[model samples]
Target: MNPEKALVWFRRDLRDHDHAALSAALSNAGQVYCAFVFDTDILDALPSRQDRRVHFIRESLAELDTALRARGGGLIVRLGRAGEVIPGLARELGVASVYANRDYEPAAKTRDIAVAESLRAQGIAFHTRKDQAIFDGDEVLTQAGKPFSVFTPYKNAWLKRLTATDTAEWQCQGAFAPGPAEGIPPLEQIGFMPTDLDTIGIQPGMSGARALWDAFRAGRLARYAALRDYPAIKGVSYLSVHLRFGTISIRELARAALADESHAWLNELIWRDFYFMILDHFPRVVGHAFKPEYDAIRWAERPDWLAAWQQGRTGYPLVDAAMRQLNYSGWMHNRLRMVVASFLTKDLGLDWRLGERYFADQLNDFDLSANNGGWQWASSSGCDAQPYFRIFNPITQSEKFDPDGKFIRRYVPELAAVPNKYIHAPWLMGRLEQEAIGVVIGRDYPGPIVDHTQAREETLARYAVVKKTG
Candidate 1:
């Protein structure tokens, strides 16, 4: 092979196995170097000190380091803006090219472009491969070369476009595994403090991801579609964070789902591609809706209500339990997501943006497109959205999803003593019964923050502004 080396810039795709860019870099070059940059631009904007993402990433990176070291290569860890750090490393290492997976986020794209430009100045070629999403922006566009806004058509088009070629795994054995080039920086020098992520009990690395996937395949895959709604049930794959960062390959997961009898679990993964394709075609949907006119809808901003919702004092048993779970665990079941989002925008009459921001802050698996799609879907402002006329009745949603109150009891303990029949709306119970339950409405727990019936009417009136533009 040639004597030149290639530097693999590892971003969200943090794994060694089936890593396209890493495998590519190692195969074509005489020597290979792997690196990761903790972008200060992003970290500076984050508000929390004990962010689960930061901690999760730390553990994942450590695992990646161990795996790479076993192959006679190690990770070059750095703390700074990626645009500055990546190219600097490329030049310092005298690498012929820098390879990485593409990030669809606008900020990340801009950062990568700048890094590519900087590397080009020194005659270094920067190559970005698609690793995060199975189908990227333009790859699945319409026949006329137009992007899709509606999901059903988009999904149909996506399924039609997918080939066996698209799902094939890139083997990372042989020449790629020969060994990594020497000279990686120490982790401690990067200004990021060592985090005790193991204590949080979150499984880390590709091995952890496979272990979880194996268990899900054995037990959870069959009932995923039905049980995924209930928060108390371990219905989800819990692989969002892994998928978010490229700790595991999307192709690997998708291939297994496609082969398995469980179409339900696979459909969930398809929904992810659906949202990513949504983001790719319409980048404007990042801050605004797929339909801009929906922004014209007047919101009934009630700060007190927003605070109550955030604090999980909504008084609607289902919505409160969902919100409380998000605050505590940084994860929420898909059913609760729709219910609480509808409660916030439709019942609380607040802007969906506020709820989106909260989820962005709290959710470990928070993907921009999915989060935006979900919020807009609940608010009836995006493609394939719920009609503005329809609003989720919180109590009914609870009774339906958690009919026996299994989920409700886990998160809302104040309602533990309430009968299953009245668990959805405990405030409706008589004072004597409330006293007997030992949890007072508006005292032991919060009373309903806003009357669902009244608020639904208010939301209808509030969204009337959209009609003029439409």
Candidate 2:
């Protein structure tokens, strides 16, 4: 039996197609109304008014609204806490049900529960569907029905469990009920300012996602495994922001990866699902270590070093360049992300949570699960993490990945004249060589903040507590 009237409360899933909640509403209801809340519960906590993510969402919403209107419906947008706004809007519209895609973040899950309770009180059914991941919850559990903590087994299970129907699009068959004529509000109207999204080469809507996917499919997917680790080349898809915001469909991407037999790229997508699964099964990883004994390790209190890392003045060329790239562009290459995270936790002796929070603040495609997972992996605190003894040599990573120093010079331009011989470690240059290159180590490019050899020994000692307890 179809519902008389239904409302679709859009959250992270922004697009009009292949949307689980939207398709369910349109298919099951006589008429459907769509709305999106700016969510002050989230917006209020943002540290900056000119957030690229906010701007990206605003632009994406405008396009979504336009797309819906073409199908004889429009989007209703509001600015308030979703808990209050969704129920109130559902009541006013006289909806029998409210449909939405599920969110996995602890805060978001909590928010959804409150909203559901409110809707239930008003006699409106609250239905949620999975739209973000290929598999979530216990769908991809182990043979004994327990959640898999390790990724390789999880990936094997994820692939083995896949079928054509899993990647099929959720078609919207029923007609949409027209929304209130008031359109989407501008960024300023919603208490946000325009950002350098255009300047930074970020194309924010469904159109942008399609363009990037097309380009990557046409050229880069074949060589992604070979060239993806190098930060200097365009060997990877820049579609992460689109994926984060649901401007593109995960199923669509997975299908393409499978069709092209690009197992490496498909493996990355599977990792996304794995992180979501990890967060779902082990929510405690949010604040504390996944392996509890890791909490005993004492992190250093080096405010100056922390500040240097954040400001891209760490003096290690690769680390500095990666930080600068993140600061300026709001995106960092995957390989550089690992390198910088290792440098922060292992070399600088800081807590992984500190680095996790910083990446959460800066990354354009910041998914809490992936951010936490990567940080934990680097710090040897989470499931299937690297051994604590493994520390990245920033110079070797730079040399191996950016052999010509192109990436370093692009972000840390003070070393523009540095010869290839000393480019990876400008501090290694003799004074005469530094003079010839016009890059004095201290005055031009700062020297390495901490000696790698000394930091490695310190890190080993610091993690000894974990070893003893384990």
Q: Number of the top candidate by TM-score?
A: 2
What is the alpha-carbon lDDT of model 2 when measured against the actual structure? 0.93
Where is model 1 poorest over a 10-residue stretch in terms of lDDT?
174-183
Give the local distance difference test score of model 1. 0.82
Collision pairs in model 2: none
TM-score of each: 0.95, 0.99
Report lDDT per candidate: 0.82, 0.93
Residue range 184-284, candidate 1, lDDT tens digits: 34334544454444654568778778887888878888778778877777888888778888788989888887887577776777788878777766778
Task: Score candidate 1 by TM-score against the native.
Answer: 0.95
Candidate with maximal lDDT: 2
Task: Give candidate 1 misplaced runs (Cα > 4 Å).
Answer: 174-200
Looking at candidate 2, what is the lDDT of residue 416?
Answer: 93
lDDT string for model 2 (57-134, tens) is 999999999999999999999999999999999999999999999889999889999999999999999999989998
Candidate 2 TM-score over all chains jointly: 0.99
